[model samples]
Target chain A: MAATYELIYWPGAPGRGEHIRLALEEAGASYSDTARLDAQKCADIVWAQMSDNNLGDKNTSPPYAPPILKDGDLLISQTPNILMYLGQRLGLVPSTPEENDIYKINALVLTALDGLSNEVHDCHHPIAKELYYEEQKTEALRRSKEFIKTRLPKFLAYFEKVLKGEASGNGPWLYGGTFTYADLVLFQICLFQPQTDSQNLASSVYRKRDGVREKS
Target chain B: MAATYELIYWPGAPGRGEHIRLALEEAGASYSDTARLDAQKCADIVWAQMSDNNLGDKNTSPPYAPPILKDGDLLISQTPNILMYLGQRLGLVPSTPEENDIYKINALVLTALDGLSNEVHDCHHPIAKELYYEEQKTEALRRSKEFIKTRLPKFLAYFEKVLKGEASGNGPWLYGGTFTYADLVLFQICLFQPQTDSQNLASSVYRKRDGVREKS
Candidate 1:
């Protein structure tokens, strides 16, 4: 049987792929993890897919990096875009355009990806992605402190508010009454070891969410 | 007459709003820039909108930051999300789902925003967004070096390759043979001072693209 999705990312690290993984798990979509199967070959495929001379005319534009998803003829990247596409396909998002919940849910997903995940990555590589985390540890300390003290709390609190808002309908979900890809993404971010009292509080709330806790 | 769009972003710096602004310019869409009217009041509005108690029950979720767009009762944020919504309404994207160009264009737009804009912002705020540039200048210099020497070249060359791809159709647009929100976004990013040879080449190529140059 053919796989419903093929996820490519750097092996051994959940990183951004965790978000995609959670969505697939929640949707019960059958998928393949390329990196887990063969890390070396997966790296080669990612390199080639990003190169100017990719295998075929499958994609109009090549992705800049990994966390690429292959669904038959379609090969796409960008975490938010991938999740949005997959969310719609897997019924993780509302089917009706009129529902309007999908767009707002996507905005929340983008915030999680951009504000939470990306900034967390920057804490380790504050100077540059190419630089070793050890080389940038001093900068990383400062960044991580700010992230723990301010940025993390700010985003987590905002999400807490979203969970409590009228639009949430009940507890925990970022929008509507059901579990969304946004919730999945946020749950993954909150899983990182809590560095402060606020983050610990946020993680406990995340743990209490039925939808978020179910897959975890 | 009612405004078709209302853009809320910080005054003075174009920042990410420039991408949306370019799309609006190319589409000839009438829009309002709130910060331009009254910076202080506009900021207050943004603050309130971000808070748990926003003005109304219109938005399903309030944006974490500005660069929010208001259209009728809908409030949306995230640069790519707003642009995609506008691109569809403005006919900037190929309307037919059969075209399959929208997804590719959106992927390209996401690349430009995430890799280019986000990294550029990191150059100044290497440690933390809350910290002043002066506070982070040393780390900023290290990041700027990596950005100028490596990251910028990689993204520009990737776009340069995209422009020259079979999908680009003889010239500069990233997709579908005409100006797209992706092209508008790439063109805007290139408008920044060219800090490296790759960027200079990319900017010059962007300048020569007829579709991109028309509105300029």
Candidate 2:
């Protein structure tokens, strides 16, 4: 079957785009990644799509950032929002309306990405994204220490407790007694941590591939 | 009807909770503000709910942070996720699947809050959220300037263009020719801006309550 989805994100970096890629991978969904095709052209396309006078067909609303997913005529951005839509279409969520489970799973996905992903990004760019990492190293070190000591432990412990809850049915999944998009999201975030750190994660959840923890 | 919705957050500050409050107010929805009732008690409740062994009915998963909404058995956190769920329940979104309009509107809301509210909060705590503002004043000043110069203008202009797009129908509404949650979210974020800065926003969308611009 032909890929029905097109993802446009920064080239050579598994930053925000990793979360979406993991969801696609878990779903085994066919998709084209523009960044991996031609980095320069992908960057050009991303910039064009973000502009007020984008080069595409004029009616589509401009995407405000990269890591955009194009499905037929729809263009969606924001990591969690994209994941929410894809989780439904890809059967990565509970296929029932019981207990408002979609919202529950979505809330978990949002919290995981916010703390593990967004805050980590901020640690590297504490002063400004416009500034280089070297320029913000002092602030980055401080922020990172606080994040690991305080926020990281809290988030990890919360998810650990969640996994043990009845919602998971004592399974490794985060919800519905089955693997869902929330698991894929958490798995992807764990991949970003160092091997030792990921190994030390509360739930012993990180998977090993070929003697090295695989990214994405 | 009595307010069945319970909102828990830090007191004496608008912060992200204001976005939820604005959505409720705009929909004329009845909801309890626990933080506003007794700030200390509310803080205690929030902390308890966030703990690994939270003193709650054990089935519900712990919220990773505050600004949680408890409606019956469901407890949700993450400002945008909470707002997204409420937007649908309160009829604050375009009530249709046409054109993937809901996702489009939600993407805009996420972008607005991420750049404006999230980044703005980071400006004062560039080094660490645990640190005092005085400790990070120099870094905060630097980040704030970049935010004011680059991020603020970019976010404002993008939303202004979104308002003018075909989805908006050349009106203040952001999607499907109706006042939706996206508008309420944007309006609330604008309220957080300084009076002069909010007035100078690219779009003439912010309104005055009681014939005066109300600062959140």
Identify the leading candidate in terms of DockQ. 1
Cα TM-score per model: 0.93, 0.89
> How many pairs in model 1 have backbone atoms within 3 A of each other, for residues 3 or more apart or on separate chains, i.e. clashes?
0
What DockQ does model 2 achieve? 0.52
Sorted into a CAPRI-style docking class, model 1 comes out as medium
How does candidate 2 fare on TM-score? 0.89
Candidate 2 wrongly placed segments (more than 4 Å) = A55-60, A97-99, A195-201, A205-216, B55-59, B95-99, B195-201, B205-216
Model 2: lDDT of residue A48: 80
Q: lDDT score, residue B112, model 2?
A: 80
In model 2, state the lDDT of residue A15. 83
Residues B10-89, model 1: lDDT tens digits: 77788888877878877788998876867788778778778766523534666778788898788888889998888888
Q: Best candidate per TM-score, number?
A: 1
Q: Please state the error at residue B132 of candidate 2 in Å.
A: 1.9
lDDT of 2 by residue, A84-152 (tens): 899999998877646567778888898888877888888898888888999889878988888888778
Q: What are the clashing pairs of model 2?
A: none
Error of 2 at B155 (Å): 1.2
